[model samples]
Target: MIRFENVSVTYEGADEQHQPTLREVDLTVPEGELVLLVGPSGVGKSTLLGAVSGLVPHFTGGTLTGRVTVDGRDTRTHPPRELADLVGTVGQDPSAHFVTDTVEDELAYGMESLGLAPGVMRRRVEETLDLLGLAELRDRPIATLSGGQRQRVAIGSVLTPHPKVLVLDEPTSALDPSAAEDVLAVLQRLVHDLGTTVLLAEHRLERVVQYADQVLLLPDGVMGSPAEIMTVSAVHPPVVALGRLAGWDPLPLSVRDARRRAGGLKARLEGRVPAGPDLSARPASGKQDPGPGPGHGKGLDGGDRVGRSDGTGRSGGFNPFRRRRTEAPAPAAAPLALVDALGVRRGRVEALRRIDLTVTPGETIALMGRNGAGKSTLLSTLVGMIAPTSGTVRVAGRTPHTTTPRELIRQVGLVPQEPRDLLYADTVAAECAAADADAGAEPGTCRALVSELLPGVADGIHPRDLSEGQRLALALAVVLTGRPPLLLLDEPTRGLDYAAKARLVAHLRVLAADGHAIVLATHDVELAAELAHRVVIIADGEVVADGPTAEVVVSSPAFSPQVAKILAPQPWLTVEQVEEAL
Candidate 1:
């Protein structure tokens, strides 16, 4: 269905010619096959996907030295518009793909452009709406939807056209775990039931590796089965990592396969307790002694509050507000942020409601829930992007919604869902320089952070030219330059590989050790396992679950990490934890 012959691409540079992003790539993707393209950030995965849709040379203004054909049509001669009927491409940013105001119209726009019959278009639109669970949101304007909702609309729009080939770059990056599973299930149906060809590039291997028919490891452009490639690939999922740590032959791609082989390893770790990080300390609360098991001490239940008392004469029902001065045993340090009975409304929808959360110094909290379940809204509320409809939100003791930007920068910094939103400079060097000046930091401080997060990134390269992961790193560096007391990140690991994510985890740990509070809204369960001390789950704009990371995540099947799933009934949340216990 797709073929690449001696393909090499290079982009013209201003002062000096740039290196080839893709070199000597030769491959063939058969019909009805799902080919997962895996590689580290900036390793030409997106560039290769663009080439298949005829966006590299014709639209992106790059040089192509080799022949590329899709469905027996040469991509060199056929532009994106010409191949629209045969191929549908969804880029990293789903908002960029929007051409209409409402979800239903966006889904129908592609079919209308193809001049499908009215009856056919209507039927396809309804099917797509049902398939993607956009039925209730069909008439809603796309602008009001959350990032993950926009992603579903973007995908549903393409699927309505019934294209033979789908070229998706990080299709599930913005989706929550359940929504990701739904999207992947839709793709699986398309491939098996309709014989559709899918070429997808994703950084989160754990979500898609099991669904892939073949793995195409990039830069080298080597293609093989998932088991064949994961054995040597630098980028991999937690289940594969666990398989490797346990010395299991032929690494497993899915949790079920790994679970079948994890029996012996589980027995080895039966009584041994994992020496995970001790993050039981809460704001205004004294240090909590380590418990007998993982995450057992000082963990808050869903209904438990810091000082609120139940009839049993015990603190219960979590009240994420300031305690009265009359309370005994005063807090050691004030909370970095406090949200009390928070409510936010966007249009007719209630984005958040009666939500209560607190960020303590040195705490790393992970905000998790289904897509469009108010995770982003809660983050925006914390960062002061959205004003609360009711109740109060304070960051560093100052009201975030009313605080000045200049003053807010020092107390709290937010890296939004779209990393590009925080970036405006042309070149990477200029961005870093501006961040340093904005934060009043020493020279090269931001650049040094960028180098640590994203090594080997050239100073002269335009921020637009960097990969999604690279842009995120640059944005994170810009935010970290200020060294704010509280940090807010939304989907921080969207496009990052395992190695890059590890670096990010290490950096955040260092920041937490320095007494900086960190909160990230994410769908990456593995990230929560590796980094979060506490997990807060939002559902339908309310706080449904809140507790220590292990206690909260392991109880929910959808939110559990692969390692935890493989070694069930055990408190181990990561392969590293199991290894440490062993």
Candidate 2:
């Protein structure tokens, strides 16, 4: 059992700018219980774990005036590694934890550090590899893994130690929906089967809610904030959003739970719910095409030009699916370029072999693979961030290297791995306004558009003071203002809860319908199946397959199925898609 007896942490000011991260926080957790610690980034969620890990004052050089005892051992008296046998940790940035180049070695590294015997280490490593579904990658070099794969390795490294308790700080924060799910699923199983007490700090709640035995609603425990940091927001995911406008309960935790709770309300409304669009109409693969093959009177591949009022859109020569139905007509025709024919590199590391990728407007693209597969690197090249060491790179009829960051901003918006990097403004409103104005919006219109695209942003707080979920929405608000034809998001749903993630997917579905070409780099197969119009797989920096999203995900059995993928080989990004396909 873990107990925080009036836990209060105060850090010495580095300068006048130095601020406190956590305040007095009293909390407790029972043994063998799974607790989820969540709040906006920079909150005391991480500090809470550090208190138990004995890394607070000991490592951070902070003034700690609290008693954090785990298993009756005072954390203040013990060091983190000294308590390593009792607690395991998986951090948000996994790249920092690699102990060796091989997956097998990485697992062995932890046990070896603890001075475990060779036979015990071998057996533990083998069991953990299979449990985490890393058996195939066991022999693979850690240098060869993708971002998601490396994260898995980080988890395996700590878990193989067989600690009594496991603490994961934003373990899935950087993973795509499915990759996040994979990692969470493994953690859930550990708590359920092995009785490893689990404490995780997470921003994304949708996937973890169903599995959580208990939830801790942490306030922004900073020494100074709008509310003294002790006010706890609701920890559970809400079942509905705008439903409040219609006077609904609005707090359903899961789909089944929501449906069960909504039955009585549905009868009271008696069709006032507006006979919501039949989700069953979704296609088995790809979105519903009115035509026989590929829909909408478009040619093969959905390539056509379209124009925008801002002098940015291409006309009939672009992908029509990405153009607004009622907006300005497209510009004169021009040949749209694909990103294939390039080899990408990351410093001394070769991230991608030559990968040829094609992008068409109105199509949602999903990129998948093990960590080190180059999905992130490939996305950067497409968005014009990283240049290809070889081969030409083309995005929106131009090579990424040729496009300036500002120019790329208009055409390509990358939802980065860490949302904090996207935020620099003092306040959430200011950040959104800055994003809109930077994207070439007229004065005053940016704020209105930000409100329209993102819900619950105007709570009156600084962007830095908001939660990770709030910050993620603020970043999205800025990106949506430009309404670019091509949108690239690394992983849009990383730090969000289930309800939040579902809302984000709903928004993306709308974007896809409006003819916005989106390329999402993630480890989430479910999200890919749901929102991706097509799925692209990258292995060792080379694209292996690029086609319909469901088709690509179906090929990998080690890769679990999303809801739609399970029912059909093709992925279903939304529930309605499955219903429609059925």
Candidate lDDT values, in order: 0.82, 0.59
lDDT of 1 by residue, 100-199 (tens): 9998899989988989999999999999988988887888888878788889999999999999999999999988888899999999999999999999
Give the clashing residue pairs of candidate 1, or none.
Answer: 284-331, 303-317, 303-318, 304-318, 305-317, 305-318
State model 2's lDDT: 0.59
TM-score of each: 0.92, 0.64
Q: Residue-wise lDDT of candidate 2 within 1-582, one digit each (tens)?
A: 888787777655422444446666777787787887766444567667777788777886777887888898888888887888898877656766787889899999988988999999999999888777688677776665555667778988998999988888778765544456677788878888878889888764545655667766666332222111112344333322212222545344444554555444444433221112222323222333211112121110111111110000000111112111111233222323376568765545667776776555556677766555667777666666666788887767677677766666666666666566676777665765676567666654545543443454543456654445556666666666677767777666665555455556766666655566778876655566556656676655556666554445555553434332222322323344323333
What candidate 2 gets wrong by more than 4 Å, as runs, is 11-23, 40-43, 175-182, 220-337, 340-374, 384-392, 401-415, 418-485, 497-517, 523-582
Worst 10 residues of 1 by lDDT: 303-312
RMSD of 2: 10.4
